[model samples]
Target: MVELAICSSNFTDQLALLSFKSSINFDPNNVLSNWTQETDFCGWVGVLCSRRRQRVTGLILRSMGLQGTISSHVGNLSFLRVLDLRNNSFHGHLTNEIGRLLRLRLLVLAENNLTGTIPPSFGNATSLKIIALARNYICGRIPTELAQLPKLQIISLSDNYLTGPIPSGLFNILSLSYLLLDANQLNGQLQAFPNNSLQFLDLRFNELSGPIPLLVATNFLISHNKFTEIPLALCNVSSIKILDLSHNSLSGVIPQCLGNFSNVLSVLDLRMNDFHGSIPTSFVEGNKLRSIDLNGNQLEGKVPRSLATCRHLEVLDFGNNNINDTFPYWLETLPELQVLVFQSNKFHGPMGSSKTQLPFPKLRILDLSHNEFSGFLPTTYFKHFKAMTIINETVGLRYMGESYYHDSVTIMIKGLEIELPGILTIFTTIDLSHNKFSGEIPNVIGKLYALRLLNLSHNNLVGNIPSSLGNLCSLESLDLSSNQLSGKIPSQLTSLTFLAVLNFSENHLEGHIPRGNQFETFDNSSYNGNLALCGFPLSKECEDNKTQLHPTPMLHKEDDPTFACGFCWKVVQIGYGCGMVLGLVMGYIMFLIGKPKWFVRIAEGEQQKKGKRSHKGGNRNGGRRK
Candidate 1:
């Protein structure tokens, strides 16, 4: 009994010494105040010991915001099995002496500021099963010595600056179930991935180039690299559930075999690549698919009808493509749809009526701009939308009465008085221009008192500018250009004190331009394309027009009937006609002087045919044929 007591006391002394040394380097706040030899080692703050068997088994001090180095004396804790010091400010080199803890199984040092190479002596801890050092500043190649740990199962070293080839030694670890090396500077051909026991693998955001290796992992991520082609071998992984290969330089048609992953795939992202060709009809047949991101590709053709059956789909991004077809009405039937981004495409047709329903009750973001969609703006589109930003610039959205105007006004209705419930008004903007929309600028637009920007340019809109627009107190930008609008410049617009940018160019507007704070800073370009407009910026004086005509409040027809009757009409018509004639004459002269190669080719072809016919006639004259 005496000899056994002596052996136990010796072990306890070693552990106490190690803990004391490590604490000295990190106890900046002195929170480990009671860590002393006089007190039993089990009484320490994070120290855990077996009750009946008086031996320390675990030491957990995670997220204490602790700072400083991990001392080498930590090796003295021979019986410690688990050490968790994650999510702290721990720094300095991970000491090689840590290998002395032969019984250690789990070591989590993730989310720290630790730097330096992984110590090779870690291989001596044969019992170690999991080691996570992710989101740290750790550098240097993974030591080949780690392969010696026979019982190792999970190793995550992601989000670090570690470089060099993925150590082949990792593949040899047959017990490794989860391996993550993403967001690192590692490079080399992706090969030798362990097929067995590996359930999860992430190698994303690396310098890896070449085809993806076939592995049995269920969750695979290898995005943001320079891979030039889809790894058909990935199709071999029948167990894959989530596959992400976005932001690569991959080109070529998406393989039809991708549909074969229907058995288990739930999320598949292949966005931002050079992929071209029609989207496969068989692509979304999988019932389990929850999310599909194929944006920023060159895919064409209509969306497949089968996608409507994917009941679990929550997000779908098919933006920035050449997809030319009518909007998919079937999309309105999706119950779980939350985010749908279809910008920069060639989709035509009206947003369906059923879309106004609560199909996407949880929808947060819906972007469908820069497309060929046409028709009136949908009023009920935002009834269930918590927040949204929809732009229809390239589309042909014609004005459909004052109701559409009210819909635009709803975006600015904010503050507690509006009783918006849980919805805190964030950013909501509308851009409707470069289309065939027409009619007078609606006076109701000013009611959207919260409006930040209003753009109505490059359209056929006609009528006097609405003075009520000045009510938009929050408006920062207002554009009303390239229209047939005719009227005096509204002095009420000067009331828009917050307005920073205003454009009223390319219209038939005439009179003295409004001056003051925001308008005074504007140059001639802001008021250009308007023939009769005269003010401080223009060389023509406002007094010149008032002197020639009698002051009439109703703007009589006799008062310069055609508006800019004498000056504008003559200048524009003569300038356009002369420019057109000049261009045609110059083109004709160039064609005559420098005969193109195509013209010479046509002449040569005609001469060759004539020669062949003459030869045939000569043979007939020589009595070769009757």
Candidate 2:
């Protein structure tokens, strides 16, 4: 019984020592409640012991959200092979005494708030194979002594503020498969390293600039930097499956040789760059290509026709370019196509044929705004577009009559005005303002229950404002300004509680303005250009309503049709016509005053020839006289 007491005392001391080594606060929850001196350490939470329970073999407390400083007493666990406290909030520097763990194989303290330099003594852990300290506040240069670990396979120090060049000896670890040093202040060109056996390598979002070195990693991500062009060395890595070089200053044409890696290449993102010229046709030829993003560039010409063949393609973003062509008909054939963004391009024509099925049936988001697309969009386009933010505003339209225009027109996007389709339902809408669309406002627009944003400003639309628009409960923005709309302001429009922006200015609207709600909040500028509109904001009241027998000018439709045809129109026409004639006359006068440089040179040449002739004549006459 005396020997048993001694053994228990020794075990308690060992347990105390183990607790001091790790930087962890006691779990308030009962997760580690069993950890006590009375209980065997083997039965403790996150503690593993050997078969005899004489030594702790492993301490795995990953993702336990453990906080507090790591205790140096962790080294007391002499037989510990693995210590994983990853994905925790543990702060403070890693204890330098961790080197005492002679049998340690894996040490991962990633995704923590641990600050301060990595302990140099970590290099002494010769048995260590994997060390991941990524996503931390650890600063200072990577220790060169870490290269001494002969069996190191993975080292991730990404998303940290570690500065200075990467240690050269680190490349000597031929067994290294994954190295992530991105999102750091590390600067310098990538030097040569062992190309074989590497699977994942990311050096992106760093100050490091220069041509990418020849690497054989299967997954390569080097985006959001100052790269000037495509790294030629990257093309040689035929085994590369995922390559991302996005959001950089890379310019020039996209290299066509990328298609050579058709077997392994799956995802390639080169978005948000200065990459100009046309997309190479070879990219579409790759049979295994799944995703390609070339958005936010100056790429011109038509999209490659071969892209349709890439059956597995999911996301294709070609927005914000000078691409001038019709929508790729073959895109509808892609089975897995999900996101197709062609916004701010030069694409024109309707979405699809009236009889044919909707293109991209499974498409979730389709942004085709700021284009030259015209005509009444087929109802089928909105049938499958249950969840989409289609922006067909007419701000980019440069031509007239190309857009859909009928006798009764309603709804406007941008500046181009267009007629709303009869079968259109739900929240979708058409913006066709600023175009040549004419005729009276259509009453059919009230049937669309889902119409949210209706803009018909800056057009030639005529007739009275439709009161039926008040039925749209989901209407948010209603713009009908710069048109020929007349009649009293619809009082029912006050029911639009969701209406945020309402513009009806520059129209021929008259009569007492509606009161309360959005109207009261809006300034007089919204109801401007309507000379007959009288209310609290404009004036006191109409003259006829002020007194019992007050004589007021009869508001005759014939005498004052609310149309201003005064000297302003004649003066504008005369000014425009005279301005054109004056421009021509001034151009001719400037041409007369200015002499061509070539003509001046010819006159100077002639004068020089005459002088030479006189000199020759004088010399010849003197010789003859002699």
Candidate 3:
């Protein structure tokens, strides 16, 4: 009778596995090729059976490219503890029968095409510990029944269509640790979270609103919400590490005690808000801060000098503010600093000489545009940017952030305020446009072989375009428009095959525009103000003997339109779109930055009007001056 009972249990599990195999409409990986009657169900791929009962306990088929609905018959495995089908193409509603798995401990079905509401029946799985249903199309409110699970620890339902206020009971779970509900359509005000074991809580990119709740997690990401005001109670959370409350409607002065949290806090992002007040200046020494972003705010006063105490600082942005101050040259002492942005602010005065031998040794991006900075461009600092001069193969490729956080910043690119969701380490640029910097293009800039964009437009810079700039083989966009620069468009510049956006217009530059490589793709707008630049893109033709043209002192170079066709279509086509200048610019940036999603969004944004060739004046306060 015992043997008969074992055979009965084996038959039940075997029938369940067969039902699962039948439900799969597509199995490109042939994962179920061995799910045949000749072989025991225990011997199938991803199947795990116990030694005693020979019943299925685990079924992990992650990234197997499997498609179709999950079979409800899977509930027959009464002893099953894990069911991982993540990173596949499984579609249809989640089988409610999964709730029948009384022994279920982990249920992972993330990164799939599964649609429909989450199965409330999940509440019945008393033994459940973790539920990972992120990166799916699951909709409907989270079941309050989830709170009943005594052992539930992690609930990851991010990147889905889940709507309605988060179940209040879920927050009350004492064992809950990581609760990620970001990138959803969830709404409703949050209740003050009680002190428990919550460690990481992400509610970003949602419609959640109401007064901010008391914080308890170490990594709290609640950006892209409708929350208003930063409560002083938040400053009391000394254990918090990463706090990102950006892109919200928060107002009022930032809690001064936030600066004191430097010892434990690592990431502080509060951009795109209406907070107006002097920045906190109590950053203590031996702090752990790595990124600080306060862009697009109404704050005034000089940058806090105490920020220099952050030894691990990597990214700092203070753009679009009313803060009046000179260059914070002291920040160069930070060895890990990579990105520094101060665009559209009250920062004035010249960037004086570097205090250290290699100032900003790891600086990859420097944007000081739209400010009142005067005097010559920081030439000494350019040579010391060893990080941008060469690619660091040792680090491989990665974004500038910690494992749980990604550093972001906003900088002017192609006249648009582009937001970088995550700054890539290899992405390098230098924007000093709309400033009063007067001098020739620094020759040392050519040493930055990895530099992708350089903008010095709307400045008082004079002298010829540096021939050494040809050494920047990776340069994609070069803007020197509306300047007093005069000289021939260097023929060596034709070597920059990746050059896409060229705006030397409104400059005194004279001679034939380089014809070969990416230069042939640019329109007359690139050389409009120069009036002297003659080439295929321009109306005037270069003379065979005379170096200058009659109408304007145009440039001279051999015309070769053949090489222009070799440029990548993906990049070249972006320039032709009438209202996609933002996408075109962002795409090129994403292509270099190594992010796929941003590259996909490159097909959007405001268009660049080529018909408007009027010169832009240097009026920083008012709107664009023609």
Candidate 4:
């Protein structure tokens, strides 16, 4: 009887497994091909059975490209402990029957097409510890019953359509550690929580408002919201590592105690805020700080020299601020430093020559546009931008970041501000436009082969555009407009195949524009205000010495409207001369016949008519082309 009872239980479990296999309408990988009665159900591809009872305890079918709704019969597997179906196309509402698995601990369905609200019956699964359903379309408020789970530790439902304020009971769960609810529509002010086990809390990309409540976490992200202030209690948490409060309306001066966080913090992002006052200048030595972004703020004062203590620093941005200071050449000592932005500030004085031979050796991006800096381009620094000049083809693409914090930077590309989520190692740019700098662009700039965008416009710079710039094979946008640059557009520039946005407008450039490659794609707007520029795009045609010496006998399609009008005048002049000769000949004959007076009157009338006709034709021909 005992053996028969065990066999019956095994058969029941197999039936439930088969039910799940039947529900999957599509399995392109054929992962469940051998899931049949001929084979032992315990031997199935994703099946895991207990040794004693031979009962299915786990179903690990993650990332098999499986598509279909999960079968409700899955709840019949009473001994099921792990149900992982992550990174699949599993769709439709989650089966409420899954809540019947009393032994279920881990339920992962992340990166799927699953929709509808989470099953409230999940509260019955008391054994559940982790419930990950991130990167799905799951909507509606998080069920408060989930907090009732005695052992629930992680609730990862990020990148979903979940709404409503977080259940206060979730914070009360002593075992809960991570609460990832980012990229959702959850609104309302946060309530104070007395939890101590919570370590990683991400509520970014949401509509949460009001003052931030008391919180203690190692990694805290609450950006892209309307939070107005940072609780002083947050600074008291000495164990914080990553604190990103960027893209918020948080005002007032940054707390000085934040500098103390450098000892443990690796990333401290406070960008796109209204925080005024000078940056904290107490970054201690031996700090683990890797990325520090304080851009788009109203902060004023010089960059503190104390930052040199952060030997691991990689990214440093202070763009679009009120800070006034000269170039901080001392920053070149840091070996890992890559991105340094100070665009749109009161940074005045010359970028004096670096005393070191290889200053900013690893620097890939250097933006100082819209400043009061006046001098020639920093040629010496250009020579030492080893990161931009060298290409490590062996290394695959990578971004600058530290742990969970992906570094971001804002740059002006083609007259628009664009924010990059992460800075790739190979991406490079040099923007020094809208300054009082004067002098020729450096030829050494050509050596930086990895350069993508180069903006040197709106400056008092003079002299020829560097023909050596042709060597920048990766350059996409080149803006050298609004300068006193005079010379022929270098024919060598035709080699830049990747050039997209070219602006040479409002300059004294005089020559036939380059015709081949990407240059041919530019329009008259690119060469506007360059009166002497002539090419296919422009109405003006380049004149050869012969074309100037001898008038064109006929109008050409490529001829300028003004030149065609002149040609018309010349033709009229020739006809008028011939008519006069003919009239004189006629008069001579008429005079012999004593009819000279009538012939003279006819000739004068013909001359007046010819003049009127010529004047009308001139006006029509000289008008600007639409």
Prediction-by-prediction clash tally: 0, 22, 8, 0
lDDT of 2: 0.62
lDDT of 2 at 345: 78
Please write out the lDDT profile of model 1 over residues 1-626, one tens digit for every residue.
97798568556644655554464466666667677667776777888876666677787888776777776767777778998988777788888987888999999998777899999999999999999997677889988889899899999997677888887778778899888887678888776566588777778767888776666677767776667776667657667777777777888998766666665777777877888998766755446776677888999987887778778776677877999887676776777765576766887766545544564554544556567566544334433443232211222212111110100011111110110101112223344445445567765554444345566666667999876665554455677878788998877566555565667899999988876657766778788899898976777688655533323234333232123122323433433222222232233233234523222212222212112112111111111100
Where does candidate 1 clash, by residue pair?
Answer: none
Q: Kindly report which residue stretches of model 3 are placed more than 4 angstroms away from their true locations once superposed.
A: 545-585, 588-626
Q: Write the per-residue lDDT of candidate 4 for residues 120-177, one digit (tens) a residue.
A: 9999999999999986778899999998898999999976778998888888989989
539-565 per-residue lDDT for model 2 (tens digits): 647665542221222433322211211
Q: Relative to the unseen true structure, what is the C-alpha lDDT of residue 341 in candidate 3, on a scale of 0 to 100?
A: 88
- Evaluate residue 98 in candidate 4 and report its C-alpha lDDT on the 0 to 100 scale: 89
Query: What C-alpha lDDT, on a 0 to 100 scale, does residue 527 get in candidate 4?
Result: 89
Using TM-score as the measure, name the better of candidate 2 and candidate 3: 3
lDDT comparison, 2 vs 3, better candidate: 3
Count backbone clashes in candidate 2: 22
Which lDDT values do the candidates have, in the order given?
Answer: 0.63, 0.62, 0.79, 0.79
lDDT of candidate 3 over 239-261, digit per residue (tens): 88899898889999988888887
